[model samples]
Target: MGTVKVLVDDLLYYNKKDWNAKVGKAKKDNVLTVVSKIKVKSAYIYELISGMYITAATKFLKFTSK
Candidate 1:
């Protein structure tokens, strides 16, 4: 898959070392928010691939669960 150009653009916009450094996970809604002067929408495929009965953290936990 091709890397999203917007991701690169966003990276340049913030010049962050990593995704989490630039974007943040919302505590209340658990939504990922890009913490920068620019506005962008953030979504992950796992949200749709998995059942709606889960949250991003839950999905992440399942993937990394041992």
Candidate 2:
């Protein structure tokens, strides 16, 4: 529908932390983790297909359960 934008903070700007801790198992997992910080200018679901799914999953986990 519209453009997708997301603001991420404290993201892995450097290659710090363990591989699992830094990137996790899936790339999507890392992306979701990063998107969690985007309170403003978050990516729009309609604009993104796959990327939004990861963010949506992150939000679901944050709101629904562990």
Top candidate, metric TM-score = 2
Instruction: Note the Cα lDDT for every prediction shown.
Output: 0.24, 0.27
What TM-score would each prediction reach against the true structure?
A: 0.15, 0.19
lDDT of 2 at 21: 27
Model 1 score (lDDT): 0.24
Per-residue alpha-carbon lDDT of model 1 for 1-66, expressed as tens digits? 111112111111112322343332323223232221222235332221111212223323222221
In terms of lDDT, the poorest run of 10 residues in model 2 is 44-53
Give the clash count for each candidate: 0, 0
Candidate 1 off by > 4 Å: 1-40, 45-53, 57-60, 64-66
In model 1, what is the error at residue 52, expressed in angstroms? 2.0
* Local error of candidate 2 at residue 21 (angstroms): 17
Q: Which stretches of candidate 2 lie over 4 Å from their true place?
A: 9-52, 56-66
